[model samples]
Target: MRVVSLVPSLTEAVAVTAPGLLVAATDWCSHPSDLDVVRVRGTKNPDVPAIVALAPDLVIANEEENREGDLAALRDAGLDVLVTEVRTLEQAFAELERVLVDGCGLARPGWLAEAEAAWRDVRAPSERRTAIVPVWRRPWMVLGRDTFAGDLLARLGVENAYAGHADRYPRIPLEELSAAGADLAVLPDEPYRFTVDDGPEAFPELPSALVSGRHLTWYGPSLAEAPAVLGAALRAARG
Candidate 1:
């Protein structure tokens, strides 16, 4: 079955589960680094005509990552589109199953089960610390309200300070973020590549956890090791 994946996390899931199923994927689908699929540009600005021309049996997308107009355009051209919405860890697992087993018609991948098992084994810390999780800078956008990354961090015992904010990804002033009363800064290296010299300096008062964006954001095989990987990073940063 030829499939086109617009979401990077889903791309990795499909690539790792059923190697030859993907005919095209977004330029941002970086995992499985040797992935040699047709690059369909970015998630927001995919080449719709090119994707349609490929004549894929199914095109996988995410509600948050992909544009609705693009999905509608593909459907208008008589292509089947499967759009996923992942807000929590459970939602991620369910959506992955939907994309792989239900949409791609493949057997349930072992990694999916392992990822679930791994998360289930996670034990929350006795004392949870609040954090200001920043996704971007310049304008300063942060994780707020319902978010996959926030849920993941919450599971890891680092609560998002702006989790009660109305906006999912709210743009707050740098001064406000620094004064958000968070114990630490959880910075991921994607959407905005936050580095040691780049992101940490912004919040001098808070401990900065330079975590892998893949482990913190992407919901695929990386989920299997995310708890361990992220837990270690948080520990190192806090200690």
Candidate 2:
């Protein structure tokens, strides 16, 4: 079955699920960097005409990952679309499996199973609560509760400083953030691109760690190494 993946996470999925069936993909879909990737018109406002030209049997999209208008356009174009979202670990696994089986009819293999096993084995000390702010320095947003960012930290036995903040990606008040009283703050590499030199006042004096935004945020065979990699990084910050 020919597949076109709009979601970047699923780009990796196609690499693992079906060895050679992917026909087109978005620019944001950058894993296994050897495939013939297509030009991205935009993440949400994708080049509809180009995608239609591919004439894929299926398109893997996400409700949150894509713009509603693009989804509507795809529907109008009479193309089959499979939408997926990752709010929790279970939902994450389910969505990926659905993409694999429904889109390619392939079974979840070794790497995926290993990734799940590693996640379940996590058990960090409760005393060292982590304040994982996926630092987007510009416009400065903090990842609050009910988000994949918060969920990833939780698996490492760390608690979110904004665990109860109802919003998914909320604009944080500088004063409130100063008072959040977190032990460690993890700065992720993308969507905001925080670096150590950005320094203290905005970043503060607490223990800091630099993490991969894609690994923590991206879900696929890449997830296999994230739990262990993140666990080690989080643990080092606590110490």
- TM-score of every model versus the real structure: 0.98, 0.93
* Candidate-wise lDDT, in order: 0.93, 0.77
Quote the positional error of residue 19 for candidate 2 in Å.
Answer: 3.6
Tens-digit lDDT track for model 2 on 143-225? 88787867888877777888788887887876677678877778787767777755355656677777888877888887888
Off by over 4 Å in 1: none
Q: After superposition, how far is residue 233 of candidate 2 from its true place, in Å?
A: 1.4
Question: Where does the lowest 10-residue lDDT sum fall in candidate 1?
Answer: 197-206
As for candidate 1, its clashing pairs are none
Top-scoring candidate (lDDT) = 1
lDDT of 2 at 232: 77
The local distance difference test score of model 1 is: 0.93
What lDDT is obtained when candidate 2 is compared to the true structure? 0.77
